[model samples]
Target: MKRLIPLFALCIGLPAAAQTPQLILESLVAKAGPASAARGEQLYRAKSKAGKTADSCAACHTDNPKAVGQHVKTFKAIDPLAPVAQKDRFTDPAKVEKWFKRNCQEVLDRPCTPQEKADFTAYMISVK
Candidate 1:
């Protein structure tokens, strides 16, 4: 019975922890309604008004999300954002929300709306 408890717990938790990119995007759309890939692309490339220096998702991610990127400040190598290039790009809902929270604050001076997040996810998924 003790061994069964742990195994059962793991089984129950597995599906919640493991999610597909489409699943995550669908959840976001549930909150924000339909997402527009074109709007997402525009937002990703738009310059920020958050600071004097130009800061946009494209500053680090580049115009092509399918290509690997380098952080402009840290110079850390970032994997491609497109799910087509990186199958794990948006697989984890927690990580997806984490990056959106951090990056939106950095680039937009505010956390992104559910609509914005859904749009971004749609755009990244569209890249092949």
Candidate 2:
């Protein structure tokens, strides 16, 4: 019974660890909407620079929920847009921020603004 008390405490702690990020990410997602997502898509597709074009979210990732990236290279494709599909991939906040910083510059010629990040996440969630 004494050993079981510690085991139960450990088990209870596990859920709190798992849920904190989910809660924060969910709060961020809740603040997003379809209109903003549409705008985000527009921002993504718009011309980024005068000399060369930048990529959009749809460029590296297939827009369809079921489709994965077909290209194989420095920018190999995957199911990038689907939230349920990529949820496990982006669970780490640091990785999420890193990709946002890199991809936003690649697509927008700058890091994503907070609105863009919110809207883009909303759009990704909408795809699934």
What TM-score against the true fold does each predicted structure earn? 0.85, 0.59
TM-score of 1: 0.85
For residues 93-122, write the lDDT of model 1, one tens digit per residue: 779988998899888989999999999999
Model 1: which residue pairs collide?
Answer: none
Off by over 4 Å in 1: 1-16, 51-54
Candidate with best lDDT: 1
Residue-wise C-alpha lDDT for candidate 2, range 1-128, written one tens digit per residue: 63243345356764223322333345345444323657655654555553123356555564454467543345655654455665654455455668888777766667676667766655555554
Q: After superposition, how far is residue 46 of candidate 1 from its true place, in Å?
A: 0.7
Cα deviation in Å at residue 32, candidate 2?
9.4
- What's the lDDT for all of these models? 0.83, 0.54
Error of 1 at 16 (Å): 5.0
